[model samples]
Target chain A: MSTGAAEAAWQPSELELSRRSVRRRASTRSVVIALISTVVFAGVIGLALVGSPGWAVVQQTFFNLEIGIESFPAILAGLWVNIQVLVVAAIGVAVFGTLLAVLRSLRGPVFFPLRALATGYTDLFRGMPLLIVLYLVGFGIPVLDIFPRLPAVVWGTIAIILTYSAYVAEVLRAGMEAVHPSQRMAARSLGLTHAQTLRIVVIPQGIRKVVPALMNDFVSMQKDVGLISVLGAVDAVRAAQIEVAQSFNFTPYVVAGLLFVAISWPMIRLTDWASARLAAREQSGGVV
Target chain B: MTVLEVRGVRKRFGDHDVLQGVDLELDAHEVVVLIGASGSGKSTLLRTINLLERVDDGQILLGGDDITDPGVDADRVRARIGVVFQHFNLFPHLRIIDNVTLAARRVHGMPKDTAHARGLELLGSLGLGAKALDYPDRLSGGQQQRVAIVRAIMTDPELLLLDEITSALDPQLIGEVLDLVRQLKSTGSTILMATHEMSFAREVADRVVFMQGGRIVESGPPEQLFDAPVEPATAEFLARVRHH
Candidate 1:
């Protein structure tokens, strides 16, 4: 009798069902809004160019463009200059970055001020836009008579080193910090000097972790060589700019863009592949 | 001869005191186990002996030399006293063989071949020779801790300070590490360990010292401390930890 009475009293509550339905509708509205925005963005881009001369000219110059077999030599020459700039600047940054990182991480008397100075240097360069840094180094420094006889190409190279070293130092610092405090304790307990422990253990692990980041930084520096055009340095971008200036046509700008893409494409793809490989190895138990 | 002495050791962080007026001594070839609650300053004391922690106020002596003296060369003294931490702070970047051989070659000026051979031999004794080329992460917690001990002993320090070396191991694996420590007792090496394994302490330690609130509340032969502790605090601590 009691079970039958309970069954008679049972009824589906409409308020609870209605509240759940309201939440579902609200969530669907948000998703709908998001999708509508994406479509609207595409529509805006499509409409914005329909009557403009920019895209037509871009398409005509880029699609119909072809460098003669003779012009290939000049393109190759520019490519070589880009390679040289990247290699030299990367080497300089490696040596300079390691020295600065070590000094920053050190303790005791001499290192404190050096740490501050290195930190200030990293911050000053990193905070400034790369173009501004290039401009300052390339044109402004010569006015001060420091490295007065140095070529514009040398000044551009210096700008790359200054900007990239700041980034590399932070990468190196993260690697160093990843080493556990207990390892330092164990080293000290073994009666090994601070320098000895750093040289043998901490630095090796740190260098390994920072390798990918360093490579990525190097790639960015390679691309930034494009900015050396402002100094009239004869890199790939400058070569294209000079060619475009003579003809008053925008084809060389597109060609310069293509050159950048050519150089950066392989580097980007290689870093991506390297990162994936590293990630796979890490998942399989490679040390960080 | 007294191998280690700590007098009026007091350590504080901010307004809180971690160790208060602590005094301790370790004789030659003695195996002392320091038992205490977490944060009782037992680990702090051991670290201070290695100069890994600078004591706020105290004097520490090793083999009649004042290690706490401002003029003393801490690195030289540390070379004579090896310490193994709870976490086997092995250099993860280096192979197990390199981790063990590095200090021997760098600090003691041992040739690479000699250091490599000794490292292999030590690994063999620990039953870890197969993993000598592997990184620290590849080894189990117990295996890594054992490797840490070998790395420390490769330096051949006169005294070894083991700070809760087996505390991090799984219960089943704790036995193997403690067994290695028990076997080490027979090697005539002076050892001071901060351990949670009560039965292991009774088995291996020549003397058992119970500490609470950063002071040695009671200490005696392992039999007496384990069987009928004189202090209530010691008895209470043993009762709490004996179940584990």
Candidate 2:
């Protein structure tokens, strides 16, 4: 009888209904506060910019919709060059960087020379500024009559691959080291040759662990592919420069910059999504 | 027949000798358990046999073959022995069935279909059939350890080395793993294990070897070692473990 009475009393009463409304109100209040803050932040920034003395001149020079639309076709064409260089250099760097990392990680006295060579390559390339390397390889190689007829764009791509591979190799090496020593032991004890262990077990895990880092490099590479315009490769930035010189308007530069961001934005989102997924997979407890 | 023999094995890390002239042997169908305190060279001895550690001075004979010879193929020798580590080191990226079939397929060059079928059969018999497609991280510690055992025995290795396999498991999960080891023993598999579970050792080991200060103090049948240890060091070790 007492249990039945307690069950009867557990039904939604006026007090419980009031408590539910209180919780709902608290959530609604937070959302309202957030919306107000966002609107105020945007309004203040917009008002200050519009009230500036040079607003009209700045807007006419850099934000002219008519000039932006006119330059879009040429800028889009130039962006194709950037995409090609990025795609080619991305593949080149992955292959070259993995080889360098493996060479550096080899054991025994027999590998000392190869290890030293790999280390020297990474140090030399990583120490020099990418711009300096690009200038030397892009301009100097032609003067030396080595591959004299090769296009400047090809030389620029090579320079990018050489510099970026060093950074990527270091990233890969760190990933390999981060794998616990026990993993190597587990693989080796399975009767796998050292090379087989690396190929089948260690390298795959290392590459997976460093995917976000690799994607970050690729995003940065997308912008640096523009650096090739210094070699007279006629990429987006160079095309934008040509437009600005002819029209005396900077709107073309803005269009080109927006294109770069448009390309990289999805990649950044992808990196975030991948990192979150990996974290969630790791944190989920095992099944019983 | 004597399947594995270790003679005058010595290993040193810097100036400290980890395994000081240790000698041991395993027959074709026997279980030898090593029990010792931490830093007593139990793990080092096991690693030396698998050639993960090169002994400073010793010879390990596997079926009359001198495996420690400089010219011997280490990979070929390792294929004949199985090992299970303390932490159930299953590859996190692989499915449970793939982990079991890896050595059979890659090292032994078994056909893919044959390897997978054998792997599934082993998992099914072990009550892990439903988990064959699940990733290692999706299995419990006990289940992962069992999968490791299944992987180790996939190729019918001549000797199995189990290094504190149950040490990292929870008390509740330890029984399941120990039960698998007992089952393997019943099938006449030769096993050499290092463990800290004294009662389990007493129950499962045909012979118990006690070590201290990088040396085997005493070894005999479990009845003699557990009930009446001959060496003072063995008695002291047993007393401390029993008190806990």
Candidate 3:
């Protein structure tokens, strides 16, 4: 008990203090060098871009601040549509993707047909380009008159959900497969049914192992939601198209691109931070 | 009464026949220890009995019930048996008490309060009561193995299968885990255990079964099997193991 007080009172030797300062100074020097090099790099790139022969035309078309300011409100209104679609699509992906992953993981011959179907579904969706899927689903479904004519956004949302769940399910399957077989054996030996083992033991560990990967898909999903514009949803991309048609300036498209980047940047940073924490925890080899 | 009857079981993985027409039986309250070299099929036999593995050919009777039939519910059969593994496969996300009591509450439909009480008391008797709230990763290897034992016995299974439980522990930690097994044996739990520790086998087993190359070479009471082996392979194995 007394050792705690003694340990707390202990101090570094002079040599240890010098080593600490040496490490601190080395990091500070690197930071300063990086800042100088980055500024110089940007300056060179800027000068080259400005010195190009068509700079005047490019600026008038793509960097028109007046047009960007004028189109900002409409683009912002359309962004609300993109946000709503992203939220709904994300929930659908989590549920449908997990069900697909569980199906793929089934063990016996009795589940072979289901396993094959789920596998084929993922392969078809993941391999097909998203643009083609959007066009086919967007234009194709209404022709069948599947129900009373619905808004194009509903079809567009369905297309995105179908494609993205393939991706999410694969990531989750990788995570589930990474879980050691012994865990499953232990759960089964304890008399838990296969479904019970998956719910209580396997899937929880699987999801944890792939949190960073899941976050990457989530960030990618935010941008793809804008693809709904192709179906004439008047989402941000569509709103930007209107401004571009009226003024014949490409500035609104650039504005829309920057808006997408603005929303996605925080999630990108979060994914990196999560990846770092996961890596650190995994290196310790004891984290559940 | 015979607690388990494994009749002419066979298992194959790739070209290797892991269990080659093996037969084994354990009577109620009989502590049988299986001694074998690596890949001798002892562990495979235990796994098949628990239905963690499917046998290519055989019938496994647990208390006269034909458990190997395709129509038989494997989960309900497994509920009547307890098993511990070499690596102490405790559920990593759960607390020690949750790991101990999960089967009792989930599989058997024991109420949460009653299961918790039973789990805590068992952990207490095993010197692990204070560590109940901690995760398995937080415990030392010996402590984790003890918790695994508690998890195994929580349901009072008709038979217990221990597959090299002490093989993964440090030398200093092995005694604590073996002591718990000794306690289980004294309490008359019908146990079929596989072990590499020859000395512990001598001390704890009522009967010793020697297996070689996927077949039971010989078996008898511990003294007769260890001291006066009838099979040349059995004596050769004992000599080689003891020489090490």
C-alpha lDDT values of all predictions: 0.84, 0.93, 0.95
Off by over 4 Å in 3: A1-6, A51-53, A285-288
Q: Where does candidate 2 stray beyond 4 Å?
A: A1-27, A280-288
Candidate 2, residue A216: the lDDT equals 91
Model 3 agreement with the true structure over A1-288: per-residue lDDT tens digits: 899999999999999999999999999999999999999999999999999999999999999999999999999999989999999999999999999999998989999999999999999999999988999999998999867898888989999999999999999999999999999999999999999999999999999999999999999999999999999998999999999999999999999999999989999999999998878876877555
Give the alpha carbon lDDT tens digit for every residue of B96-205 in model 3.
99999999999999999999999999999988999999999999999999999999999999999999999999999999999999999999999999999899999999
Among the numbered candidates, top DockQ falls to 3
Candidate 1 vs candidate 2: the lDDT winner is 2
Report the candidate with higher DockQ, 1 versus 2. Answer: 2
Over the true interface residues, superposed, what is the Cα RMSD of model 1?
A: 0.9
Better of 2 and 3 by DockQ: 3
- Candidate 3 chain B lDDT trough over 10 residues, lowest sum: B18-27
Q: What is the lDDT of residue B38 in candidate 1?
A: 91
Q: Per-residue CA lDDT of candidate 1, range A1-288, in tens? A: 999999999876999889999999999999999999999998999888756769787566544455323244465577678788888988988888877788789888867889899889888877999889889988899999756488788898889888888888888888888877777877877878988878777888788776778778877887787787778788777776666665566566666667778878888888888888878877997555
- CAPRI classification of candidate 1: medium
